[model samples]
Each structure stands twice: as structure tokens, then as C-alpha cells.
Target: MLTELIEIIKDTFLPTIVVTGDTALKTDLALDSFEIINLIGILEDKYKIEINVIDIVSLITLEDICNYIANKKMP
Candidate 1:
């Protein structure tokens, strides 16, 4: 999940992981509301899971996303 999220960040944002870690999604990535929405859509389609908008709002870093994805996968 971390690797996939890293790839998404690299493809979506020009910033490398060096400057931003997990939190880069909200900070260094500079992703706006629309971008976040698009990202959620991409993730949902690729992961085959339904993501709530509230989750997106609460997410602030790469670790957050990774943890969220992991939690969703757990039984």
C-alpha cells in the first residue's frame, strides 16, 4: 500500500518523496479539493473499495492513507 501510494503521489505530483513523506499528500503535494476527489476516485477504482469523503477530509499524510487502506482491508 505504501508503495502504491508513493507511485500515485509521484505520478500526480511533481514533488519527490525526499521533500515530502506521507503528509506530503496534503502539504507538499499541494493537492486541491478537486485533485483529492480525483485521487479518491482513482484509488477507489483501483482498490475496489468505497471511500467516504469524510475519510479524505481527515487524511493528512501518506501514513494516514496507508493506514486507512490497511484498515479497510482488515476483516
Candidate 2:
């Protein structure tokens, strides 16, 4: 899932420079507030999970996003 998320990020945002784990989303990926929303929409649609704005604010890293989706699984 992490790998898939990384791929999605890469495909969604074509970074001019190399992106690594340490790279920040707002700086390296240039993902601003609006892009974040767009990303959430894509993720929600792709994963079939509902994402809240608070969830988006709480996410800082790729792992965070993956973990959020993982935890939202309907049991």
C-alpha cells in the first residue's frame, strides 16, 4: 500500500527534482492545500473510503496517509 501510494504521488505530481522519503509534501511535491484536496478525492475514490478534512490535516508523511486509510477499514 505504501508503494502504491508512492506511485500515486509520483504520478499525480511530476516533481522536477528527485523525491525521497525525507522530502516534504508541500515543498518537494509542491502539494498545496488545494492539491491536498484533489489527492484526498483521488484516494477516497480509489480506496473506497471516506476521508474527512481533519484526517487530511493530521497527515504529514506518506506513512501517515497509508496508516489513516488502513485504520479506516470497515470491520
Best lDDT among the predictions, by candidate number: 2
Alpha-carbon RMSD, each predicted model: 2.0, 2.0
lDDT of 1 by residue, 1-75 (tens): 777777887787654555334465656777888888888888888888888877887778878877888788788
Candidate 2: worst-modelled 10 consecutive residues by lDDT: 15-24
TM values, all candidates: 0.82, 0.82
Candidate 1 has an lDDT of 0.75
What digit string (tens of lDDT, one per residue) describes model 2 on residues 1-75? 777887778788863556554556676577899988888899999999999887677787777788889999847
User: Given candidate 1, what's the lDDT at residue 64?
Assistant: 80
* Clashing residue pairs for model 2: none
- In order, the Cα lDDT scores of the candidates are 0.75, 0.79
